[model samples]
Target: MIKTRVVVGVDGSAGSAAAVRWAAEEARMRQAELRVLIARHRRESFALDARQADADADTSTVQTAVQQARAVAPGVSVRGVALPGYAVPVLVHAAEEAALVVLGSHGGRSFFGQAHGSVCSQVATQAQCCVVVVRGGEVPADGPIVVGVNDDPDASTIIGRAFEEAAMRGAPLIAVTVRDGGSSTAEEALGTEIDLQLDPWREKYPQVRATREVIGGKPDKVLLQQCRQAQLVVAGARQQGALLGPVGTRLLQRAECPVLIARA
Candidate 1:
């Protein structure tokens, strides 16, 4: 049987290193192959000497990332490659056959800079599979996997992924639904809706201890607060023209832990 592949993009930045570690662990847990990729921009000049130097640097970067990944996951199969192209397109193409695409929250000034907003968002929006943006400090091994729940049709995709992850990591799952009103009736209704969404997944993954919460506040703010104690946050991509909606964008930018954007 062909093993699933997890593709991760890495520069020489600390954030990319963190991504490598996270991706390695995830690949090991999923029993997948880890592909470490480094994208080198093709220079306009095309000077032979400069091109050679760029190739050498790219090779070194990818090799170093591969070593790091192997160190993190000694039993998992890992490979490293340096491709010549822009970061976003290169990763998106790789994601075509990948089970998951993992990236750092920050890619320094060159590629994955969160400040630029174009690279990460574009890849997350365009990738064929789910995208994980590794952010914040070290994830607590004991922390629960938090997932944002709503009435959207894609809620099943998000909750299903969340339960799968929780089962893989042997962690509890917390399903959260945010409401604009503080009325008791609204809270009860929202909680019931979330339970309806989660019941099937709970039965499917009986090992995962799951709970539901209905909070009255902004979606992003409430999720961010929950992220403080979460090892990972799962959110659904918008079903419309856009993929990462406002809540997903904010979590990608400011969440206290890694955010997994479940693709519809």
Candidate 2:
């Protein structure tokens, strides 16, 4: 089992319910514990509802969600939490002790693109571990786990984590590399290099079958395509693109499945 664990944000919404389910399965497959985090709405503290009432409500909802997760993921150790702070800061604090932080793509009531949803965006950008965004599906067996790789120094880490996840879940690893090879000769050169990188992965995790493909066009198109059938898609935060919206402005928001951006 991984030394740390996965913490998922929950807010008693359908999307968060999906997040709870996804995080539970991932933790189960990894033999890691699942932490169901319910960030106490700071503003709620001053609401018409008394502190005891809101706390009780939040705690009860978290308990129910944890029970549901236990039912869905039989053997996974599930834990509940109703934290007393804003979502992002509390999550970042939790991340200080987790291997992965999982969340729903869209928050409990906000669009994924909200400029004010600092918790989700901040956790995605600043978390020290892998941050997974479960966007579209909740069915456990929907599709394969996709990984985006390049010559970036973090590529190997991405490969290892993706392979580990795929192997545990008995899912295929869709290893994808986006190439901006300007011409036919350039394409061949980059494609060969891509092959070399993937070659080592085949031997490293022989049980997890992998397929490599090149996106000769723009980077975003290639990534989006790879994630179309992905149950989980992972990307490394390019040092250069750290300010380019975590996973990238478009890819982060448009991915069809959960997008895990690895940051160590």
lDDT of each: 0.87, 0.75
lDDT of 2 at 132: 81
On residues 22-88, what C-alpha lDDT tens digit does candidate 2 reach at each position? 8887888777898998876545537666777778878887998899789889998888988877777
Error of 1 at 127 (Å): 0.6
Q: After superposition, how far is residue 1 of candidate 2 from its true place, in Å?
A: 11
**Tens digit per residue, CA lDDT, model 1, 1-264:** 343999999877788888899999999989999999988777779899989988898889899999999999999999999998889989999999899999887634756333425667788888989999999388788999999988777889999999999999999999998888777987887788788899999999999999999888889999999999999999877733456889989988899899998975
User: Clash totals for all models, in order?
Assistant: 1, 0
User: Could you tell me how far off, in angstroms, the CA of residue 176 lies in candidate 2 after the best superposition?
Assistant: 1.9
State, as a TM-score between 0 and 1, how close model 1 is to the true structure. 0.94
* Count of clashing pairs, candidate 2: 0
